[model samples]
Target: MPQNKKFGTFAGVFTPSVLTILGVIMYMRLGWVVGNAGLIGAIVIIIIAHVIAVTTGLSVSSVATDKKIGAGGIYYVLSRSMGIPIGGSIGIALFVGTAFSIALYLIGFAESFNAYLGFGTTISDLRLTGTIALSALTILALISTSVALKTQFIILAAIGISLISICFGSTEFVPTTVHFFSTENAVPLEVVFAVFFPAVTGFTAGIAMSGDLENPKRSIPRGTLYAIGVGLLVYLFLAVFMAYTIDAEVLKTDYNILMKIALFAPAVVAGIWGATLSSALGGILGGPRILQAMSMDKVTPTFFSKGKGQNNEPVNALFLAFVIAEVGILIGELDIIARVVSMFYLTAYGFINISFFLESWANPDFQPKFKVKRWIGLIGFIACFTIMFKLDMIAMIAALAIISAMYFGLQRKEVKLQSNDVWKSVWENVVNKGLKRIDAQVEENSNWNPNIILFSGKSDHQKYLLELCKTVSGRTGIVTNFKLILDKENSKPPLKKIDQIVRDEQFKDLGIFARQIKVDNIYNGIKNIASTFGFSGVEPNTIMMGWPKGIENSEEYSKMTQALIHLDYNLLYLDFDRVSKFGNYSSVDFWWRETDSKNAEMMLNIARFIIASPRWNDTNIRVLFVNNNNVDVSIIETKISKLVEDLRVNVNIKIINNAVEQKTFYTIIEEESIATNLTIVGIPDFNPEKQAEFVLKTNSLFESIGSTLLVKAAQNFNELDLDLLNK
Candidate 1:
C-alpha cells in the first residue's frame, strides 16, 4: 500500500510524536517551578531526566533493530512474539491514551487563546473555549489526512518560531539577586519530584509514532534523545532566566508565568501561543496513524483501515480521538489531565522496557542489535514509577480506574486470548522492570521495507531452486523459501540423500532457507507450514509456486488456479511461451481479476522483484481487472482507484458487459492476449453462488488467453507444490 519511492526519514518517526509531547508542556509554568527550586536544583532535575530518557531510548532501540518491523508497527512485534490478545489490549490502551492527549492539548490551546485575547483566566472561560476547541479539533482531524504533506511544515515553523521568541524575549531580563542554591524557600523534595517528573516524559514520546517511522531503529533513538537533550537545555535556560529576572514572590504567584515574562518583552506571548497550537495539531494528526495501522491488522474495528482518503488516514479514529480528548479537557481540566497523561505514559514505558528485556533473554534465538546492562533497565523502571507516588493520589486513582475499565471492557478479550504462561511472564517482567516504564510493547521499527517471498519444493530440483533464490536475493533482500511436503497419505519411503543434501546445501547457503513437512495434501500441508511460521493470514506478499511441470495444458491448471482463487494467494506461472529458457526473461506482467485480494500487494512485489532482476530490469508490469455486468460497477471503480493510489504500476480494467455472444467475447480476449509478459486472473473457488457470475465473466477470458496465469488462493508454497503435481 506504500508508494515505491521511499518517504523522507526525517519527519516520519520523531517529528510528529516528539514535538507533540515537548510542545504541549507549559514551558513558562515549568520555568517558574524550576526557578522556585533555584538554579542548582533545577539543573539536577534536568540531569536526572536526560539520564532516564537516554536509558529508556536505548532499551526501545535494541528491541526495534532485531528483525523486520511492520506498519502495524510495534504492536505487530509484541503480537508476533506474544499473542493477538495482549497486542489488541495494548492497541486499545494506546488509542485511549492518544485520544486523551489530543483533548488535553486542545484544552491548552483554547485556554492559551483566551488568555492571549485579554480574557481573564477562569474555569468558565476555559469551558467556553472548550466548545470552540472541540469544533477545531474535529475539523483538524478530518483535514489532517488530506493535507498530510503540510504537517511537517506547520510543526517545523512552530518549533523554530517558539524557540527563537523564547530566547530573545528572556535575554535581557535578570533578577537583582539570584540564589543558585537555597533551602529556605525550596519546596519539599517529594513535591518537587512529583511536578518535575512529567518534564522528561515528553522525550520518549517519539516511540509512540513507531507506525510512521522511515527508519525507526535509528531514528527513534536519535529523535527521542535529541528531543530530551534540547528540552533539558531549554528548561535549564528558562529556569535561570526566570530566577534571575522575576522576583521570588511573583514567580510563586498564580499569574501566567509566560505572560509575566511577556510584560518584560512582549514577543514571548507569541512563542507560548505558537507552542500550544503546535502541540494540539501534532497530537490531532499524529495519533490517528497508529490507530489506522491497528485497524488494518484487524486488531481494532475495520473502520480505521478505511481512512479519510489517500495515505490510509484513519478519519474515524481521529474523530473519536478528538471526542475523547474534548471530554477529558472539559472534565479533568489541563493540569489534572496532563498529570494523568504522564502517569499513563510512565506505565506504558515500563511495559515496553519489560518487553525489550523479554525479547533479549526470553528468546535466546533473538539477540538485540543494541542492548544495555540489565541494571540500566532495572533502574530506569524504578525511576519512572517512583515519581508516580508523588503525583496527586486523586489523579493516580482516576488513571487506575480508567486503566481498569479499559482492561475489563476492552482488554478482557486479550486476557482470554493469552496463555497462563504468557500472562505470568508479562506480569513478572513488568514487576521486575520496576514501575517507571510500563510495558505496552511500544517498540516498532518502520525502517524495514516490505518484501515478497517466493516458495518452491525442495527435492530433485533443489539445485535450480537454490539458484533462483540467490538470483532474487539482490539489494532489497528478497526472501525465497524451499518447502518439501512429504505425503503421509502415500506413506512413501523417506529420502536419506535428499535430507542430507537439503541440510548440506540449501540450508547451508548463507541466505537460502528451507522447511520440510509430511502432510495429507499440499494445500493443507502448506497452510500448516504458514501457521508454524509467524505469518498473519496468508502473508499478502507471497508467490505460491516456482514452475508447474509435466502437466500438459489442461483442466489441471484451471483447477489449481480455481482452488487458489479461494485461498487468495498470488499465483506466479513461469511463462513457457515467453521465458521458457529460464533466467533469461526480458519482461514481467500480471493480469488481475476484479475479486483479486488487493492488487497493490501483488503488483508491488512483482515490480520490486523485476526491478531487482538483471533479466527483467526494464520490464513493464501490467494489471487487467475484468468488469462484468454481474459485478457492481462502483466496487470495480473503488478497487481500481485504490490500486492507482497504492502502486505506480500500469493497470487496465476491462469492462465486459456479457459473453452471451461468444464471437464478441473471443475478439476482446484475442486483443488482450497479444504480445505481453504475463496475464493474471483470479480463479473461482470462493463464493459458490457467484460461480455462475464468474463463469459468465471469466470463463471466456480464461479460455482465450496468451501466457495466462490462473491466480488462485492457495496455502503457502508447500501446499502449492503438491497441488500443482497432483492436479
Candidate 2:
C-alpha cells in the first residue's frame, strides 16, 4: 500500500510478463501443439499468434506514450481514446476475461499437481485443487499487488531452469523423421493455434501494472516487447527440440512430456507449478483494477471504486473478481475456460487496436513519443477478430453481442468523458474537407436545395415558424434560425452568450443551427444579413419569416423582401393558423400559374418537403390550375400532369376552367382550398411604392384557408425535374 514502493521495468513489467508468458501453456500444452501441428506448422502458428501480439503491443506502446496511464491499464487507455461508452463495454469484458484466466491457470496448476500425485485423478479432484489454489492466490493478492508481483521473480527463475533443462536433456526414443506438417487425425491448425495463443497473452500482465509502475510510459513498452521476444524464442526452440527428441505419437499422448524430456524431471514439475500459480496471481492482481477503473469512470457502481490503505488498493473490486473466478472454477474444464477467455481477450485486444487507429487517424493532436505506423493498429484489429472467429464463431458472436449491448446501455447514461471530444474533431475534419470539395464545383439550378435562413424573432414566440422551416428543409437542406434582437444592449458578450445558449437549447433536437444577431433596424438588418449569411459552398439561398402581424411595418418588410430577391434569395412567408395548426395534416393544395411558374415550382418543392416528414407522410397533394386562357383545358392539364410526373410526386391535378370576370383568383383559392389542411400560394410581383397595398391584399386573400405558405422565387428557375426533388 506504500506509495514509494512502486516498481520499475524489470520487477514491474518484464518479470510478470515473462513469467506469465512462460506459464502453464508452455509447460502443459506446447508438446500437444507440436504433435498436432508438427514442427513447421507449429512455428507458423507461433508466428501468426505473435504477429497479432506484437502489433497489439506496439499499439499499446504508442498510445501509452501519448497519454498518462492510470490504474486500469488497457481500460484506461481505451476509455480515454474512444470515449466511455465503448471503453466501458470492453473494460467489463476484459475484467471478466481476466477473472476467467485466473481459473484457467489454476486449473492448469491443479491438473499438473494431481497428475504428480500418481493417483487416478478425477475432474472432482482437479476442481478441489483449483478451488484451494484460487483461495490462496486471492488471499495473496488481497494483501498487496507489490507482494504478488515480487513473487513472480522466483517463478521466473523456476521457468528459466526448466527451459534450460529441456534444451540439454537426453531422450532415448527418437523419430526416424521430423514431421513438418500435421499428422493424420490431428486437429486443425486454427484449433491448435487457439490453445497455444494464451502462452503469448502474458504480455498484458505487465501492462496491467500501469498504475503501480514508477514510469509506465517507459516501462510498459520496453518490458512488454522484451517479454514477447523472449517467449517467442523459447516456444520456437521447444517445438523443434520436441519434434526431434521424441516421436509424434508420444508427444500427442503425453501432456507431461516436458517433465520427461527435462534433465532434472523435478525442475519441470516445479516450473509448471510456478508458472500456473504466477499467472493466476497476475490475473487476481490485474482483473480488479479494471473494475476499479470502470467504477471511477462511472461506468460501473461507484462502490467498486473504493480502495484500501496507502496505495488505494482495489479491495472491493478484488472481491468481486474473486467471486467471478470462483464461478469459472466451478465449470471445471480447462479447454472450455480457455476458449471463453480467448474470446473475451480477443474482443478487448481488437478494440485496443481500434482505439489507437482512430486516435492516430482522426486526431491531429495525437502525437506519441513511441510511434507505430497507423496501419499496424488496423491490421492488428482485423487479425485479432479473424483469429477469434476461426477459433470459435459462436463464442465470437456472443462476445460481440454482449459488448454491443453494454455499449448501448452505457450510452444512455450521462457518463461524459473528455475522450468524446475526439468524435467532435473527427466530424469537424470531415465537414471541412467536404465543404472544400463542394466549393470547387459550379452552382447549377438542377442541384438547387433550400439552404434557408429564418428571421425567427424569438424561438419561443415563433415555434410554429421554426417547425415549418425545419419541415420544409427536411434532412437534405440546411436551416439557420436567427433571433434578430433590435436592442444593441443585447449584443454585449455575456448577454449574447446567454442568448446563444437559449437558442441552442430550443433548436438542439430540431437540427437547426440557431444564433442570436443584434440589429439596428428589423428590415435593414434582415436584408443585410440575408444578403451575406454563409460560405461560398453552403450559403443560405432562401429567407423565411412569419407573416407580419399588421400593416405597421409593411413597407419595411416589402423593402427587405425586395432586397433579398435582388440578392438571389427565394422568400417564404408563413401565415400560421393558431386554431388548427396544420388541421390533421391530411391534405395540401398547390395553386399553380404559368405566369408565376418559378414561385409555383418552389411551392411544389416545399410541398414535397412537407410530405417527406413523418407527420405529413400520408398527406395527399392537389395541384390546381385556374385555366382562364382560351387555350385547351386538356393541353394545360397534360402539361401540368407531365410536370408532376417529372417531379416524381403523387399529386391529383385539378383544372378549373372559369371566366376571369365570374370569379376572382383570391375567391377561387378561398373556395377550393378551404377543406385542405395546408395551402401553398405564389406571391405576386409588386412595385416597392405599393408595398402596403400589396401586403394588405395578400393578407386578405387566404383568410379562410387553414394554413398557408406564400412563396416568392428570387428569379425564374429551370423547369421542375427529378434531380431537384430527389437530391
Candidate 3:
C-alpha cells in the first residue's frame, strides 16, 4: 500500500459510514417502522437503537485509541484484546454478516428499481436484478476501494437532497390517526428494531477500512461518532415527519412511501439508488478485509490472505464474500435477509463491547487516549444481546452456538495472537486477591487440603511417580514437581530450562506445575525449598519421594525425613513395582493399624482422593486389620465399618485372625494384597541410628506387593472429616 495514498478522516471514515447508515433501511424500511411503531413508539425504538450504537461506538473508539489498530478493524481490536479463540469466532461472524449486508443493500436497490420501472415488485424480478447489481458492485470493488469510496460523496449529496425534499414536502400536519403504540396488526416492536438496527451498524464500515487510514486512532472515533450522530438525527426526524404527514395505512403497506411523500419524487428515487449502491459497494470493500485479516492470523485459510496491487486489496477474499452475498440474494426475501444480518451484527457488536470492558477492567495498562467509562462498554454488551433475544430467541441461540463451535474449533488450531491479551492480567489479579483473602483467615484442621511437592530427581525416570501425585491431587488440590539437579559447580545449566520445557510438554494436560532446582546437596535443597516454597495460604503440606534405594544415602534420606516431620510436612514414599505397576487398577488395600491412627487417617484420605479420579472410580477399597492381640475380630470390624460410614465412603472391612505365630504380619500383607492394584501402608518412626535397618525392613515389607504408598502424618489433628475428604 502507498503511504501517501492512505485516506484521511472524511474520505476514509466519515463518508463510508454515513452513506451506509443512510442506505437501504432509511429509504425503504423507515416508513414501515414509523407505521407500525407510531410516532412515540418509533422515537423510543430510535433512542434504544442509538443508545446501543453510541455506546459501542465509544467502546470501539476507546480501544482503537489505546492501540494502533491494524486491518480487520473490529477483528483486530477484539482478538488483540481478548485472545485468538474468541476473536476468531466473532471475526468469522462479522465477515459473514458484512457479506450478507451486501446482499441486503442490493436487494433493496432491486426492489426500488423494479418499482420505478413499473415492473412491479416480484420475487423473480428482485432476484434477477439483485444478482446483476451484485456482479456490478463486485467488479467495482475489485477495481479499487479508493474509487468506490470516492463515489460515496455523490451518494451523500443525493441523500442530503432527498432529506431536504422530504422535510419541505410535508406542508401539512395530518396525523392523529396512528396510535402512540402499535396497532393490533402491527409487528412486535423488537422485530421492527431488529430490521432498523442494521442501518446504524454502518458506522463500522469505516472501522473495517482501518488498514487504509493514515491515522486510525483519530479518524475512527471522530468519523464513526459523527456518522452515528447524523444517522440518529435523520432517522428521528423522518420518523416524526412521516408520522405527522402520511396516513398510517399508506405508510404501513407501501415500501416506496418515501418517494411518494417527497417534494420531487425523482430526487428520493435517486437517493434510494445511490444509497443502496454505495452501501453495497462499502460491504464489498470492507467484508474482504476482515476475511483477509483472519486468514493472515491463520484462523481462516491462507488463500484468502493474498491481496492484489500496492494497496494489497483482498481480491480473493472479496470473491469469497461475493459468493456468500449471492447466496443471500438467492434467498430472495428482504425481511429474512434483514433478520439474519441483524443477528450477525448483534453478535459482533456484543463482543466488541465485552472486549473493551475486559481490557478496561482487567488491564491496568489499558489507558486509551479517548476515554469512556468502563461501564459504558458493559451496558453496551448487555443491550446488544438483550435486543437479540427479544427479537428471536431461536436465532439468538443458534448464533451463540455457532460462535461457541467456532471458538472451540479455533482453540484446537492454537493460533498465537501477536498482541498481549488481557486474560492473563485478569487471572493474575484474581489469584492475588484470592490468596490474600485465604491468608487472612484462620487455619482449621477441617479445611486442610493436600498441597503436595514431589522431589523427582529425573522426571523421565519417574513417570509413574508423577502420575500417582497427579491422581491424588486431581482437580482441586495443588501439585508441584521439582526436579533436583545435584550440581557441584553451582552453575545454572541452560539444559535445565530445556528439561523444564520438555517436562511441561510431556505432562501439559496433567496440570502439574513443574520446576527445576539446582542444588549442592539433595537433603539441604529439599529442606530449603520446603521451608520457603509458597505463601502461608497455599504452602505444600506434603513432601513425596521415591523409596530409598540403597544404604549409601540412607543416613541423609533418614535425616531429611526427620527434618520434614519436624517441619510439619506429611511424608509419602512410593515403592512402585516395575513389574505389576498397578495391576488392572481394580482394587486398593489399606492396611489400617490401631497404633498409628494418624497415619491411618492420612492413608484413608489418600484413598478417597484416588477413588475420586475417573481412572480409579470403580476400584474397590478394602481396609484390612490383622488381629494379633487376641481382641474380638467382630468388634474391630464393626468399629471400622462405622468409621467408614461416618466418612461417607463405601469400603469392605477384612479382619484376619492371627491363628498361628508362623504367619507373620508381613507374610499376611504379601499374601492379601499381592493381586491388588495398590496397597497403602503406614510409615514407622525413622530411627537415625538404625537408618539402614529401617530402609531394608520397609523396602522388603512391600517388595512382593503392587505399587505401595507408605504414608506418615507429621502432626496429629482432629480426625479426618467429611468436608476435607470430599473437597
Top lDDT model: 3
Each candidate structure's TM-score, on Cα atoms with residue i matched to residue i, is 0.52, 0.91, 0.90
Off by over 4 Å in 2: 1-3, 37-41, 170-184, 188-190, 240-252, 389-394, 417-421, 458-461, 488-499, 503-506, 659-662, 684-686, 714-717, 720-727
Clashing pairs in 3: none
What lDDT score is found at residue 391 in candidate 2? 85
lDDT of all the models against the reference?
Answer: 0.54, 0.83, 0.86
Cα error of candidate 2 at position 6, Å: 1.1
Instruction: Write candidate 3's Cα lDDT for 409-470 as tens digits.
Output: 99998999757888897898788888999899887666348899988856444888888888
Q: For model 2, how does the per-residue alpha-carbon lDDT over 204-285 read when each residue is reduced to its tens digit?
A: 8888888889999999999999999999998888888889998888888888877777899898898999999999998888
How high is the lDDT of residue 185 in model 3? Answer: 96
Point out where model 3 deviates above 4 Å: 1-3, 38-41, 170-175, 408-411, 414-418, 459-461, 488-504, 626-639, 656-668, 684-693, 720-727
> Taking the candidates one at a time, how many backbone clashes does each contain?
24, 0, 0
Error of 1 at 384 (Å): 1.8
Residue 511 in candidate 2, Cα distance off native in Å: 2.3
- The true-versus-predicted C-alpha distance at residue 390 of model 1, in Å, is 3.7
lDDT-better candidate, 1 vs 3: 3
The residue-level lDDT of candidate 3 at 550 comes to 75
Off by over 4 Å in 1: 1-7, 72-77, 81-86, 146-158, 168-173, 176-196, 203-205, 259-267, 296-299, 371-374, 392-727
